[model samples]
Target: MKDTIEGFLDLVKERNGHEPEFLQAVEEVAETVIPYIVKHDIYYGKNILLRMVEPERLISFRVCWVDDSGEIQVNRGYRIQMNSAIGPYKGGLRFHPTVNASILKFLAFEQVFKNSLTTLPMGGGKGGSDFDPKGKSDNEIMRFCHAFMSELFRHIGPNTDIPAGDIGVGQREIGFLFGMYRKMRNEFTGVLTGKGMTWGGSLIRPEATGYGTVYFAENMLKTKNDSFKGKTIVISGSGNVAQFAAEKSLQLGAKVVTLSDSSGYIYDDEGIDDGKLKFIMTLKNEKRGRISEYVKEYPNAKFTKGKTPWGEACDIALPCATQNELNEDDAKTLLNNGCICVSEGANMPSTKEAIAAFHKAKILFAPGKASNAGGVATSGLEMTQNSLRYKWTREEVDNKLKDIMTDIHKSCIEYGTEEDGYIDYVKGANIAGFVKVADAMLAQGIV
Candidate 1:
């Protein structure tokens, strides 16, 4: 079994040796999914996983735009149309300085399983550019988004490929991209999500990913006959995912004590209440300010410069920041501090060693693909709303989102249970998500 796994990984590495992030994602899935394939005769000798690892189409193009200094700038953009067996290609578009083929490929690959777990008709795909949106004027962002979409428009459609926001790409960027798509296609369609609510965007879309992570954690706790009634929670990242996870945890009677960013984490022993959360929404969404500013607004909070909040004691921890932000030492610290539950709000936030540590400790740990799927799931809902030319109320959308998260949790349990009465959610999510796509690929026959 070890040799088989190594051989498979060798093939992948040979093809993607330059892509460390992509290789890491593949290796993680292979560790669990390969064993399942070996046991399931239907999957063995099929090379289905190999086919899934390779993208159906990879589009690359140049994006040129003008900055405030009246200088022309160029950036590379890409879209990995990963798989469309179950439905259309669906994922988010990131605009960060770190965008690359390896990162986008990894994200697109994970999206395949994450979308399948959601039980949505969407498939997996991802696109992005190395363009940084920070410090850019509104006009500059608009120009870049428009240029990016001008090239992207030729390859995507409402029913072909649907893109949403990720990292640097937000509602403002989406608005510009959508505006360009509408002009080029000469029609208003849901080619993109994360739009302003007044313009065909779904309610709770911004909060869905964060809310879903907490909801999954709640379900995990329920299995142990517990709840978040008065638990202390520490969440990393101060963006959309972190803020919303904090909000939902607070609503469920949990004390959210931390929220972090690139600078560092802020620890509020008093807990971030509704007013504080509102301030965060404005700080990040409107003001575009750094998290350090949070200390000035609230004297009770202590800002830890250049450090993660994982060291802070808490009952639950959510890594809502970027990839590989939490490592083995951080996981060990959390375990030592008596933290019992960990849910991911960012893609691949926890390192491989951290995951192994969590598994060894038997803590309830969820990978980002499963825990943070709500963002894409709501994007799926937004796609549905666009097709129907109708909108759902906040209550309606929120209920659906909650139901989907509950169902995803159930799916994880159905496949992830062990003889020792422990739930290896990582294993469960990988296999459960794999089966659906594998079966679809089988039915479709070599596409």
Candidate 2:
């Protein structure tokens, strides 16, 4: 089994040798999915996994726009239409300086399984650019988004590929991108998610991913006759995912202690209540300020510069930040600190070594594809609302989101249970997500 896995990875590495991030994502899935494929005769000799690893289409173009300095700037943009076997290409568009082919490919590959887990008629894709939106005037950001959509619009459509916001891309950026596509196509379609509520946006879209992460953790806790009530929760990132994860955790009677950014993390032992979370929403969403300002607002919270919150003792740790944010050492620290659960709110936030540590410890851990899928699931709902030319109320959307999370949790448990009665969520998620898409691909023939 080890040799077979290595042989497959060797071939994949041959083609994607330069793409470390993409290779990492593939290796993680291959480790778990390969065993299932080996045991299943229908999937054997089909080379389905190979086809899924490769993108159906990878589009790259030049985005040219004028900056506030009246100078022309050029940035590369990409859209990896990874797999459309189940449905149309669906994912988010990130606008950050770190955006690259490797990163996008990894995300697109992960999206395939994430969307499949959602039980939605949507495939996986990811598009983004290396354009940094920070420190830019609103006009500058708008111009950049417009330029990005000018070329991206040619490849995507309401039914072909619908993009939402991620990382640097948010409501304001989505508004500009959607506006360009609408004007160019001369139609107001759901070509994009994460739009303002007044313009075909779904309620709770921003909070979907965060809320979903907490919901998943809650479900995991239930398996052990546990709950979030009175638990000390430590979360990373101050963005939409972290903020809303804190909100939902607080709602469930949990104590959220930490929130961080690139600069550093702040530990608020007193817990980040609803009021503090609102302040953080303004600090990040409106002011676009650094997280250090949080310490000033609440002096009781100590700011730890240039570090993560893993060292703090807690019951649960939600890594809502970027990929590889939590390493093996961090995982060990969390385990040593008596942390019982670690749920990912960001894509591939936990490294391979870190995951192994958690598995060795046999603690409750949820991967991003299963835990962080709420964002894409909600986007799928938004697409449905758009197609019907109707909108659902907040309660309706929220209820649907919760049901989907619960279903995902059940799917994980169904496939992830081991002989020792311990749940291997990673294996369960990878296989559960794989069976649906692999079957769809097989039914559709060798596309």
In model 1, the runs with Cα more than 4 Å from the true position are none
Instruction: Please provide, for model 2 over 1-447, each residue's C-alpha lDDT reduced to its tens digit, 9 standing for 90 to 100.
Output: 999899999999999999999999999999999999999999999999999999999999999999988999999999999999999999999999999999999999999999999999999999999999989999999999999999999999988998889989999999999999999999988989998999999999999999999999999999999999999999999999999999999999999999999999999988889998999999998998888898899999999999998899999999999999999999999999999999999999999999999999999999999999999999999999988999999999999999999999999999999999999999999999999999999999977
Model 2 scores a C-alpha lDDT of 0.95
Model 1, residue 116: distance off in Å is: 0.4
lDDT of 1 by residue, 1-447 (tens): 999999999999999999999999999999999999999999999999999999999999999999999999999999999999999999999999999999999999999999999999999999999999999999999999999999999999988999999999999999999999999999999889999988999999999999999999999999999999999999999999999999999999999999998999899999999999999889988999988899999988999999999999999999999999999999999999999999999999999999999999999999988999999999999999989999999999999999998999998999999999899999899999999999999888876
- Give TM-scores for every candidate, taking all chains together and pairing residue i with residue i: 0.99, 0.99
Candidate 2 regions exceeding 4 Å error are none
Model 1, CA-based lDDT = 0.94
